[model samples]
Target: MPNKPSLTTPPANDPSLDNLGHPAIPFPSSANPPVQTEPVVEKTAEIMQPASEKLTALRAQAGSKLRSETDQAIRKLGAHSEKLYVSQAKLLDNCHSQLRKQPMIFLGLAVATAVAVSVLLHRQMR
Candidate 1:
């Protein structure tokens, strides 16, 4: 017959496990350990400072470019509006000249258009 192992005995080789099959908690040996954080923090700050300055400069350059583009667009709109206004004024002048030269023809056409519209409306009502 084979013998059974005793439950009360602990294994000798492994120090990480306790007798109850749970992991052992580690205790710190040194009284005061050094933090050693200042050099890393200073290096990070030194790297980030140049990056931040470049970012600020890039933002300013983009803003100036956008402002110039906006100004150019506004100027183009103003020029187009002026051209439209001048063409409209010329059209109005030509219409006025034609009307002055031949008033009776325009009056007859107007009467004919009114008669045609009224006849269409009367037909629709029926």
Candidate 2:
């Protein structure tokens, strides 16, 4: 009769088996221990510091540029408004001269405008 190996006995060539034929419990290796995270945290902070400073500098530059552009726009608006004021004053002076030269014609035009507005308002109410 042939001999059959029992389940409790490990093969002789298995290094993971103890002298008692039980599986050997493996201990953590000292050469490859869990990494200490302090260095990584410090390195991350060091990298981010330069980025934060750059962001602040960029924000300052953007703010200065925006302020300069806004000042230019305000100056342009002021110049345009001055030009419009001068043109309007000239137009008013011309109108005044024309009215003084032809008082009767201006009075007739004013009466006609009033009559047209009254007729429009009366139709709107109806």
Candidate 3:
């Protein structure tokens, strides 16, 4: 029997074979070139221009509205903070006047409160 070439081994120097020995699919070569794409791109841009402009205008309007609403909310919070400070100051002044009017009563109440707290603490420690 004579030694024959195996079917598993591809033929060497085959023009149709790629570097890895697989058959290469035919691609567009110098004979058939790709079509120009610039006109298609320009048409698409023209179609989208109106929507793009509307989107930009909407964005600017929304930003301005948001800033105005934020400023209104900040002003409201500032007013509330000022009112709270005034109320708190008035409460402190009232308490001071009451303490000064009856110093003996306030001193007695403070001592009694301290004694009660100490007794409660001593009980919890046990």
* Per-model TM values vs. the true structure: 0.62, 0.64, 0.73
Query: Which candidate number has the best TM-score?
Result: 3
TM-score of candidate 2 on Cα atoms, chains taken together:
0.64
Q: What are the per-residue Cα lDDT tens digits for candidate 1 across 1-126?
A: 899888875665566542334346443326535557999999999999999999999999999999999999999999999999999999999999999999999999999999999999999999
| Clashes, model 1 | 0
Is candidate 1 or 2 superior in lDDT?
A: 2
Across 13-113, the per-residue lDDT of candidate 2 in tens digits comes to 68774333334644334753666799999999999999999999999999999999999999999999999999999999999999999999999999999
Off by over 4 Å in 3: 1-31
**How large is the C-alpha RMSD of every model relative to the true structure?**
7.8, 10.0, 5.8
Ranking by TM-score: 3, 2, 1
Q: Mind giving the per-residue lDDT tens digits that candidate 3 earns over 1-126?
A: 999987785676675653343346444447646667999999999999999999999999999999999999999999999999999999999999999999999999999999999999999999
Error of 2 at 63 (Å): 1.0
